[model samples]
Target: MDAALFAKSLLLGLAIAAPLGPIGALCINRTLERGILAGLAGGLGTALADGVYASLAAIGFAAFSDALARIDMPLRLLGGAFMLWLGVREMRPAPPRAPAPVRPRDLLGTTASTFLLTITNPMTILAFAALFAGLGLAATSSNADAALVVAGVFTGSMLWWCCLSGGVALARHRLPPAFARWVARLSGAILIAFGLAALLTALA
Candidate 1:
């Protein structure tokens, strides 16, 4: 159908997901700590959420999106609390030893954790709405066109994660245990600060 429109939406998705925010930090941390698969799991979760938001925007679900926004404060609070907990868990001391086996549950856990983290920010929908409107793909787009664009969004987001995780996995062997530990703690501190800021904003 509209290949140009689909390509634009794909780029939009890449731009949205490219930011090195909390999710990016988490993915990198997991990649370094575990392996490439673990990192990709985290990315997959966020990508799925992006797809969900993009789908809503493509379908022009204005009313439903607005309804989610109404509880934005609560969602932020929940997300902040979870981040704090996750940061604390990451900071927990671990013996310098061999890496543990990557279980199916661990991948699922990473996926679930990132998914929860991404979806809590209802602002993502607003972002998609604004972006889609700007691109003239929200209300005016045909169902077929919207579907293609949404698929492109998912592909673009997933591609970013794959690249990030792959890079981190390659570097994992170069990092010493002590350095990895420091990175973990530093990431924890950053996450804690982010959590506090979000919590304070919610209270305000």
Candidate 2:
């Protein structure tokens, strides 16, 4: 494995995840509502999805790519609907209690939900493919190097999530319930808007 290529892939992963999109919002909201563990679980799910996409891109399988394209519209619609439901649930008033304790089942559910959300976006594979090609890794990298790149991406993505969730969790204790509730509502609104946009794009 080329250390330099792996390092570059790590940076690329960080850059890809650094954008404050639906995933970021979801992570923050989960952290604020259920604590850092929950947020990390969500991040883990996202990282796994990222790794999956990276592998697909690295392999450059036309059949796999074509399959993703074929179901793109359905995936978008499903993702949008799920987001709408999640946003509505988030908008509800928080009960007068501390953030819920993270149970094993809760973690599983959180991870699975975020994984589903991340995987639904077929664009992620395109983004990875573009980045790999732009870096010339697609044409030159060996199988081992590609594996390293995939690992690097997963590591980098998880690292970012750790930082984000940790930062939010640290501040969570200081914020009053009302303020937290307000943030929740705002995040919910943002999520709804994203969902609507996704639906529109899919329809268009």
Q: Indicate which candidate wins on lDDT.
A: 2
lDDT of 2 by residue, 113-171 (tens): 88887887544545665676676656534688779878988988899999999999999
Residue lDDT tens for model 1, 24-111: 8788888877778899999999899888877777776666467666877998798789878877877863655545678999999999
User: What C-alpha lDDT values do all the predictions have?
Assistant: 0.78, 0.79
User: Residue 48, candidate 2: how far off, in angstroms?
Assistant: 0.5
The TM-score that candidate 1 achieves is 0.88
Clashing pairs in model 2?
A: none
